[model samples]
Target: MSEPREQRAARFKAALMKSGARSDTSLYEHLVRLLSRVREEQPQDPVDVLEEMSRELKRGALQQDRGALRDVPATTPGQWLAEQQRALFSHARDEDEDDLVETPLPNLAEVAFFFQQAGVGLGGEEMQKVSLALRQLSDARPLRSCRFWGKVLGTEANYLVAECREAEPPGGAGGEGPGEGGDEDAAKMIVPPSTYKAPPVVPAEERGTGTNSSAYFVCREPGLPWTRLPDVVPAHITAARRIRKLFTGRLDAPVTSYPPFPGAEAEYLRAQIARISSGTQVSPLGFYHLQEEDEEEDEDEEQGTTRGRVEENPDFEPLPVTAMSKSLSAWVHHVPHILTQGRCVWVNPAEKPAAEPDEDEEEEEEPDEPEREEGPALFTPLSEDAEMDRLPPWSSRLSSALVPRFAVAYVRSNLWPGAHAYARGRKFQNVYIGWGVKSDAAFSPALPPDPQREFPGGPEVTEEADPTPQEERALRAAAEDKDETEDETEEDEDTE
Candidate 1:
């Protein structure tokens, strides 16, 4: 029987080899596990067992390949698989398509100018916010008649030609051009070519006769002459009017600043005062690239301060962009508004600006009285919120003057409260509806709780009342004595 089985098995092996079967030893272990499971489930049928083994061997080979390639890079799984994909796509390749790539575009300086113009026109809350920022950043400089432009072109050389009008004569010199006229007319005139004959050349000696001599005519390097644009004052004023509109009718409303509260309030007030006194003119002398300066130290300090409190204080608030603008104007002009009126008070009457008052106006004025000076405290708190509703007449006028120079935009109410919640696990998210920011000069929150006192803990043994008590011999003896006496009395009763 054993000899017959061996002969059958040998014949089967020879048949497998002849049919081009390949050895797959890597999947041998998996094949064995599969055979074991099959043998356990179907112990009697050898034919079924063999069929199951064949099917499991195929599955084992697939699983073994997956396991072997598990650590391979995702880009390419197997050489054979990659080759097959390449073969499929390679069959339909297109050769006629152009390979030329488009070049990236260039940035233009004129675009920045256009944005500046457009931003001025936005003229609303954003304008006021911008004005306030500008006022805070403003500095003094001499009157600048020309705005210098860089990166001009050859054909665009004519743009600066009109700017040469200041050097021209009062009535305008008669040049060879067809339409030369008075100074005003010449300023607006366009010269048309009168003749083809070699143009009547104006000598160098005659160049400054008409429009070239006045200081109003801009001067710059001939090679890169600056292009002069119209003054932005009118645009600035328009934007400022927009800003004024936000606060003019609503003095009682609250405002926010960018830096949040406390520190920001002080910083903003200081910057605002600086802006008012300095004005908006920038000095070309000190102009330097921001990248060239060593700002690391200043930045580090700012970061240190901002990082700590900003995330922790929930009640922190900022000034409104509109208020910052108004504040600057009020301070610069010595105008009294809701905040400024009570703060900057009056400069000494004698120190007042020289004014030639009308006789009738002077007659109506009261005699000079001793001016009250501020005590040790520079500022006193307002009696009530109602007192902040009005501004003295002088403050209104000064703010109006600053209207041409600065614009404010984007007046946010507060840096959303997170400061209190971050350091403490205490959550503070809700903001009061229609709540307004007021000066903290009058009130501030309690100091944070002591850290050590708040979180003390440790393991220690503590005594608790125990209901179980140890037996006492003395107490038991007394109980036994009482029991014996009772028994003796019962015996006497029985005897009676």
Candidate 2:
């Protein structure tokens, strides 16, 4: 089976020459270095040494190629969507600056300035893009009112939210184009479908400050056309509370989990925005004095002229900025507390019986349970100074805690982390730039390994130590005894 040494040497020389098509100088040098290293160390297995060298070369090659690992340019609005955004802010043909019609879009520039003052806002670059993108959005759609809601950080990309009130409802005619359609049409399909189904009926929401008052639009970057989110229902809110998920920044991404979310990422974002706004939206003490709206309108109705309908507070005043921040009581929840059923309207603030029914009249009782729904009234005192924890749900302090005059009253909401507001004299600004998650009392997130306490554990085998040989023998003996008993029973049956 032995071949001549000259013949083997000739085969090796031929293989080396053809390694890179034609004579390869790099391969020859690499082989020479490898052979020299192996010859000096005297490796027991040259084959294993060759494999190790190949792996090392691969790793080194990957590390050396800096071009492959270069950073991607961040998404920006400067280059894209420029024309439409400018057209909305200015008339194309007109030269005069006076004709520059103002847009109802919130002055995010000023908002950004306020954020800078409070030390909680986006950077200059992101703010500029966000501002530009917002203009484009306002131009693209018909909005009753539009404002920068907040930025929600996702895993792959962050979402810029635009809180808007539609001048017309989504189901109305002429809702086409990007950002035009408020519901189903706004979604971007990552994957195409052969079949489709109609969107679910969205519950009609009444105006006034509440959870569902405004619709939310999201985009990965400012220049991108906004995708309008679906109106979140109570069920979505209830289920969202049961789990925590990091967004993947795609419109049609499915939320595959327990207590099953009814729709895609859009619906999940809608639910989260609703939940976040309900809890964190706040104002300085006495910033809003709610008066009973349309108090005398329903005179002809069954419930006759009521005592000014105990709804919006008629009169409220403040002492001063320094005095307000001295204690936490000065601050109040400007937004209404969301009921467990997800209604944000301040109905039944406390459990007091409505007017006593007549002797002939029976009590209008709910069939489900006896007690009426109850919650704290709107603008209820936040919490007292004493009994306050190291980290209270809300903490109030002046820009200069003791000094007055130039001090701005800053109140930070620890419950939602990034929610903050500062009141200087009458001027106040509220900004929330966060992951759009509600901070719980617990530190870690609700995840698998240690599942949430609310949900029951799934079926799983309990881990146990391995049995000894003697224990195994005993188990086998028990099995044999059972088999013998069964055989004896069968034999007795045969005899019978």
Point out where model 1 deviates above 4 Å. 1-471
Model 1 lDDT per residue over 107-137, tens place: 2133232223223122343223222222211
Candidate 2 per-residue lDDT, tens place, 1-496, comes to 8999999999887776554433234455567767777788787888877879755654554434445467877657454556434443453575556523566687778777756755778899778878877777887888877888888888888888988877875443111212223655545646666344442232323432355667788888766678878666655676688777778888788997665676778878887888777666666567676545475556523322121222233354545878767776767666666666555532332334567569998765543333445456666766732222455778777666555766667677777777887666555656677877776755443454554355345556545779999999999999999999999999999999
Q: Estimate each model's TM-score.
A: 0.15, 0.56
Best by lDDT: 2
Please list the Cα RMSD from the true structure of every candidate, rounded to 1 decimal place: 34.8, 19.3
Count clashes in each candidate, considering only residues at least 3 apart in sequence or on different chains.
36, 0
TM-score for predicted model 2 compared with the true structure: 0.56
Q: Which ranges of candidate 2 are over 4 A from the true structure?
A: 1-102, 168-209, 295-320, 345-370, 384-391, 400-404, 443-496
Model 1 residue 494 CA deviation in Å: 0.3
- Among all windows of 10 consecutive residues in model 1, the one with the lowest summed lDDT is 416-425
